[model samples]
Target: MAFITKTHQEEALAALQDLVAIPSVLDESQAKPGQPFGPECLRALEHTLALCESLGLRTFKDPEGYYGYAEVGQGEELFGILCHLDVVPAVGQTGWKTEPFTPVVTDETIIGRGTQDDKGPTIAALYGVKALLDAKVTFNQRVRFIFGTDEENLWRCINRYNEKEEMITAGFVPDSKFPLTFAEKGLLQVYFEGPGSDQLALQAGGSLNVVPDHAEYQGSEAAAVASELKKLGYDFQQQGEGIAVAGKSVHSKLAPQGVNAISRLAEALVNTGEFANPILEIVGNVIKEDATGESLVGLFTDEVSGSMTLNVANITITPESSRVGLDIRYPVTLEKETLVKALGEVCAEYGVTYREHDYIAPLYVPLDSELIVTLLGTYRELTGDMTEPFVNGGATFARAMNNCVAFGAMFVDTPDYLHQANEQWPLASLYQVMEIYAETIYRICCK
Candidate 1:
């Protein structure tokens, strides 16, 4: 079943490098009606679709340009390999040995922004189907590789696909780690605002899906803020008119594992004699070191999806507006309304208003479902890994539809560098991923 060859491996790596070279981060300024996400994303989408088309797979580029797909074989049932071409921004991240958009290859590894998070797996899946096609295997089902553009933000691509394309009978997203991920926590992003302040002016963080790594404040009280941060034993540098604090960034799903610079800066700023917005006050004192909702008075965990994690994703204060962004991942069993109600009560006490910016209800598939059993069984037969399907805090396209779960391209030894600087993945492991996807596709589609 290991049908991938040396040429297959080389081609997969080359395609991955090509994809990583595109800075396909979301850019609305350059977006037009036909190209909904932006020019770069549209380029990535077209590039991937064209690559698949060259391999003799039936491909379709969406007319509106929100999504595209490549398909192989013909059958009534559709099996999907979910993937996204767009990546997160790499503009302000630090500690890169090579350019984030430039793929730097070593004998054993490749380093790039989208290498591990998605682009690597995407190429693997693409060639996985190609290898099976080369084998001339008759497929009992049609396997489609769905390419999305706005996965890191609003999921407009997948939404448009659902509206216009045929739904998959079953699918697996290659975004998570090996074995499988059967449950994903509910994701809720909130925007809290209060009366504007002429005195406070600050902006921090990038996307709500990533923990902010750096935050800076420029004000008359910069030196005071520096003193406070120093007393609190936080790492910061104070320049002439501003103080900047640095922290570790990780995926928002793993907020507990990251050091949120936004929350730290807010804490230091308020303690250093600067006027604090009520939202800032809450972040500084209440959610100080706890990523769980205990500080927000809404910490609730269930057995299904583990802990309720919260992240101080971003902060912005202007003369006319004061706002803070909170990224919350809650237990799958918890309803969105229940969580929002509890959070709104807390915000009201601080004289701040709470509104939902984005919401994706939790996804859970039973272990006995045909889709899970098939994927889990394929993984077991190939690797002899007895690991069971598990739940996670991260969100994937697996959560977007029914009978879908995140099945891997990452193995047990693969390092996680999603949404971080110097993201890299081992070449040997990635080739193995291609081999696995090939077999899995064969089993699900052909045999």
Candidate 2:
């Protein structure tokens, strides 16, 4: 029997549209007292909480707009459904069939910035719980849909929520691909800075977790760099002694797949010999095009989690100093301390100072655990997919809670458009996810 019906799908789509209409990108400039992330992000949280309230679910907005959650049922043990309301900036991205903030619903898919990345799955899960409520199903445990506002940035939203709310007993996050993620790699964001030259000024890139799509540098050798860029068959142009290079952008987890604009510009700078000495050497020699960390501090790989990846997400050069930001994902089997020490050694050798920003330790749930068994069994039964649960390079809200794992929202064969232009969520896939969440909620909470 179908767990989510036609009415549920309609309601979910309507809710998704309302949430997607707001440009909830984090802007620290607009941040204030109650709105910690930004005004738009806070607005998205308020709209979602209101929607839940309209649906007869008890909702709670964090005192300081860090996070919010909607609750159903009554029990001491809480089963959480974690999702995020904040999205990455889409203002500069091109090739969108519709405006990035405008939700476009066609016969097949929902097209927008936050559609597939998170907001779509959020609505689906909400409707899934709504189905159970409308059916008057009793539950042995409570279900709470927790929404975060700073997922694309530092995850301060969830951090504050954890400090304030009671710990969840067990749960799943619909933020990654199915058959379910049993393990996730550790994440490290590091900054490297050193004294530089005044003759050159360089800045480019966006979020530290995304492959830089564009980079520009202005220096004494801008003309030479432009010539080299043309010779190398790169898309570049000169503007007032500055040359800009355009490259494709993809999630840092899949860094190997995208052409990094920051690295490309760095290579040209090295060739032109206009940049500072060791800074150019570090960029040209150590952090070239390879996504693997082999060139930086060597590589770590294991059968369970796969190889480590590194992305040179951003770079800035000024008269006083030059700064480079890196986003690294290491295998679950490796220790964070070991990786950090190795990286520090390499940076010190190049006369650059290394500073750590944010670190998320690896999350590994035993494949044989009851939580994995239940979620994996439900996924296989619903989709008839024989693929086993696997490790992921991407971290999720699953890591923030105890005895939790990332489940569904994306299927095994679904094309990944998260954090890229033309982000989309198939209507049929969302409906299917709603049904799965409905059934999973019943089995985990009601039974």
Candidate 3:
């Protein structure tokens, strides 16, 4: 029997619309004492908690505004469903049919920043719990919908939540693909710094996890670089003595899908012999058009987690120095020490300093585990998908704890627009996930 009905879908849709309307992108400038993430993120958290409370569930908002949860049922053991309220920045992105934050509901889909990534799934899971509660289904364990505020940046909210809250026995995060994700690659965010040229100033890209879509270089050889860009058929504009190149943007996890403007600009500068030696060495030797780590350190691959991927996500050049940010997703079989050693050698040879910003160890749950079996069975029973569980390069909340993995919200063979412009999710897919969540919650918590 379907656990989610038309009324439930309508309610969930309404809740998602309200949540999507808030531009909950993290803003460091708006950070305060209580809301360390930012004002918009706090508002999104407060709104979600309020909605959960209105649904007759007990809720908790961390005093420091790091994380929050909505709870139902009563038991010593807790089963968690983790989701996030904050979204990636969409302020200056292009190709949106409407405003990025405005919820556009069509006959088939809901389009917005968080619609596909998390906010829609969060509301769907909430209503799933609401359905179970409305039906008066008894449960032997507690169910919690944990919400984080800094998922797009660092995972501070989840870290803080674990520090203060009770540990959940088993759980799933609805932020990845369906048929279950049993393994995830390790994540490493590294930064490289080197001396800069006084004759050139360069800046491009935004987040460390996104491919640079725009870049500009201003200096003595700007005109030569601009002429080279014209010959290369790039869309460029002259700004003062600089040239700005526009390229396609994509998630760092899929860096090969987009043209990185930073790399393009570097190529132009190198061809014109205007870039500094350090910059020339790093760009011409370390980074390349391909996402594979072949040109940087070395390539690592495994049967379970696939190959290593490296993305040059952000770059900035000033009169004094230049910094290049890289996002690397490595396979589980590789040792962190070995990778770091190789990177250090490369940096030393290029006359640059390297520092790692964040590191997330790989997550691999055995396929024969009870949690994986149960989630896979539930997905198969609901959607009849027989595809085997797979691995990915992206990190999720599931990596924060044991006995947890990412389950559903995205299905097999579906086009992923999670961090891209015109982010969207099918309306019917929401109801489908609602039914699956309700069944899984009932099976895990009630039975």
RMSD of each: 5.8, 5.5, 5.6
lDDT of each: 0.88, 0.86, 0.86
lDDT of 1 by residue, 336-396 (tens): 8888888888888999998889888788888888778788888888888897777882678
Which pairs of residues collide in model 2?
A: none
- CA deviation > 4 Å runs, candidate 3: 88-113, 191-299, 310-327, 335-338, 341-354, 413-424
lDDT of 2 by residue, 143-217 (tens): 999999999888899999999997889998888888888798888998888887677777788799899989987
Q: Say which candidate scores most in TM-score.
A: 2
lDDT of 3: 0.86
Candidate 1: which pairs clash?
none
Cand. 2 TM to true fold: 0.73
Question: Clashing residue pairs in candidate 3, if any?
Answer: none
Q: How many clashing pairs in candidate 3? A: 0
Stronger candidate by TM-score (2 vs 3)? 2
User: Quick one: best lDDT, which candidate?
Assistant: 1
- Rank the candidate models, highest TM-score first: 2, 3, 1
How do these models rank on lDDT, best leading?
A: 1, 2, 3
| Residue 26 in model 3: lDDT | 89
Model 2's alpha-carbon lDDT is 0.86
